[model samples]
Target: MTSDPQQDWQRWHERRTAQVSAPHGPLSLTGTYWLADHPDGHIPGVPGVWREEGDAVVLTATTEDGITVDGKPLTGDVRLGADHTPIPESRVATGDRRLVVLRREGLWAVRDFDPEAPTRHVFTGIEATPYDPRWVLPGTFRPYEEPHSVRVENADGRERGLGLSGELAFMLEGAEHTLQVAVEADGSLWAVFADATSGHGSYRFRFLRPAAPAADGSVTVDFNRALLPPCAFAAHFICPLPPPGNTLPFAVAAGERNVLAG
Candidate 1:
């Protein structure tokens, strides 16, 4: 690894911009159609009839409607489970658009991803502060006695469960702070947080993903790698808000601030 933190941060920022502006990235999301809101199985701008049946979503489409499933034209009904694959690999397609099925808290929704989405077409870049070493600090992870779930509001204005597995404690500006975090599948710790810069000098909230703690629970809290949540790029994403106690009282002037003006 490079000893220069600024170099590393620049590389990270470059990769983030590439990912965000990719054809099937968050910027490509054009719509999130909740099945319950359309009882008749008809979604605006979508060609198929989608209905929630038990634990799966059934999509009925005829070839004349021009919908394809798994790369072949669809002429009958298909039962689709949640789209666990990547956006480009989603089974349902209409020309260059992908239909991703998802379930959250027993609610079924279909997300439409189009390569030609206006947001993606006009994406400028991410606004961020140059990396400063001062934002890096030593930390310790303390796992909860048991996993806990908290009810939090999502970006879409709905409440949902936010699972937390541990607390990350660190010292900044001579005071100790703690943030609730979730353990990702890869063992990293993910935290949603907002500081004094939120909604003023920075995005309303940002995410910090720290490497897994060592055997002694030692880790690094690096705010220079903070990220804008998915909702910052697209309105259709239902990203969860920062959980209680995760908000820092100080201004975090590093990392990404917002999407650059397009």
Candidate 2:
């Protein structure tokens, strides 16, 4: 732990604000075009003809389309897999707009990120409570014997498989609560959760990512560091909602509340 936890939180919050307000951040996301929905390979606003192949998306475009791949003008066909780089550095670009190829649950989709998106322009800041020591609680992570998947409804109103790795148990306001969590590749824990404040005082749902647990499974569950999900910044994000049992019964008046717009 830092000697000055409040100062550390202030720095973290500032960094998060800069990240979300970046040119190609979540606020700049304009749309997610599922390839299956547009069989003709033509998405309404996105250039190029996109068709899903065995494991890649074949993009057919011409000089008139003004699409570039890896900084070179693409005049023919190019096969692209899911983009793993930052949106601004994605392989496909039509001017300042990035066309990110994404594959989820064997379904192919394209995300359009435009720096000039209206949502980005209107984003003022994130509404967050000041760092409070009381919001920091000791927690424990219990890994499942085997990981499991649950079908959860996403912000886009689509059902998708949400992978769960374990349970994160913590205490709040004299009550014990547990949330289903997903373990990241680096061993950190991520959770999607909501409280009584959701939709009224905060966003509908928020994300909490605790650092890797200790050898004894001890960790810090800091609500002061809670984050508004991507869907809070843009409607196009398909952020999964809080799963059953993940919602807390009491209000959590900490962390990020919502996005402030002009």
Candidate 3:
């Protein structure tokens, strides 16, 4: 890889903007309907009858409903598991809108992603700070004796378990800082965090993803790539909030500030 941080950051920023503005991206999400809320299987503006059955969602539609399954017209009931594919490839669709099934902590929900959503059309771009070498610092990852989960409020006002596998420690302005991090399946480290800038100069909270630690537990804690949570782009996403100890006491004047005003 090239050693030019500025060039790399510009490419990353461009890719991030393209991804966010793409059809079926976070901006396209319109609604997240929990199956339990509508026991009668009649979603407010959705055309199909949807109900939870065992571990799958059963959707029933008629030809008049004009719903499609795997690109074919859906005329009868079909059992669908949670969609693991991208939004555009979701199994169910109504016109240009994709219907995505989601299961979280045993609760099932359906998401509507429309390519022509108003939010997607109105998106200007993400507002991010220029790459600064000062924000990139050496860090150490210390794994916990045992992974744990903490209860935290989600963007949707629900409390759920947020899992943590370790802590990333680094120094900023001669002060030591730490953030609880989750170990992803790909060996990356994910952190949900907030700082003094949060809810003030920046979004309420942001996400940090660092590469997996080295064999010696050394890592680079780069704040220049801080990300706006998915909820920042759409109101329907249920992103988790920062955990108790992940809030930094000082302002972090780096990374993404917010989505550009439309």
Candidate 4:
């Protein structure tokens, strides 16, 4: 971390804008078709027969359907696993659209990322507040004996398990506060939270990803970098809502507020 937090924030904000407006970015997502919802194997607006078979998704298409697998035109059935690669490098694509296979909690789905999506074209930029030093606070992470999952409503109105690994405690306005956080594979901490400003001055909810804590459990809880979740850009996303007690009583007037409109 550099001593000039404003410069660092400006760079982060620029990178975030570029990424979200990219060809295959969240704004470009047109749909997330769950195979279980389409029993007949036909996904709306997507040309292919998709079915879940054990651990892989079976996609049957023809060259006439204009679908390609691994950059080659497809003419037969191809089993695909969850796409972990970047959207541009997905194994399935058709023209300028990428079909990303997704698996979560034993259910399978496919996301359609079209470069020509209307949302991507109309996106102006993100509405973010300028860096403020007050939003940066000292915090601590207290890990649990064993991680647990909590059922939370998603942006798509579905319920899903939100795994929680610990709590991040910090002080603001002379009061102590805490939020339930999940431990990422990379040792970072993630939180889905909201505040008084949410749905008023900012998006409905936001995400906070803090770096790994030190041996003493000390970390920086910087609201200056709070982010608008993917759902803020596209309705197809199923971002999890804030869990119980994750909502702060006060307003947070920092970080990315919303997607700028044209």
lDDT of 1 by residue, 1-262 (tens): 4988788889999999999999999999999999999999999999989999999999999877899999999998999999999899999999999999999989999999999999998899999999899999999999999989999999999999999999999998789999999999988999999899999988889999999999999999999999999999998998899999999999998889999756
The positional error of residue 91 in candidate 3, measured at the CA in angstroms, is: 1.2
Name the TM-score of candidate 1: 0.98
Q: At residue 215, what lDDT does model 4 achieve?
A: 91
State the TM-score for model 3.
0.97
The 10-residue segment with the lowest total lDDT in model 4: 1-10
Candidate 1, superposed: residue stretches over 4 Å from native: none
In model 1, pairs of residues that clash are: none
Ranking by lDDT: 4, 2, 3, 1
The lDDT per prediction is 0.93, 0.95, 0.94, 0.95
How do the residues 1-262 of candidate 3 rate in per-residue lDDT, one tens digit apiece? Answer: 4699999999999999999989989999999999999999999889999999998999999999999999999998999999989888899999989999999999999999988889999899999999999999999999999999999999999999999999999998888899999999999999999999999989999999999999999999989999999999998999999999999998888898899856
TM-score for all models, in order of appearance: 0.98, 0.98, 0.97, 0.98
Task: Write candidate 2's Cα lDDT for 1-262 as tens digits.
Answer: 4799999999999999999999999999999999999999999989999999999999999999999999999998999999999888899999999999999999999999999999999999999999999999999999999999999999999999999999999987677899999999999999999999999989989999999999999999999999999999999989999988999998889999999999
Off by over 4 Å in 4: none
**How many clashing residue pairs appear in each of the predictions shown?**
0, 0, 0, 0
Better of 1 and 2 by lDDT: 2
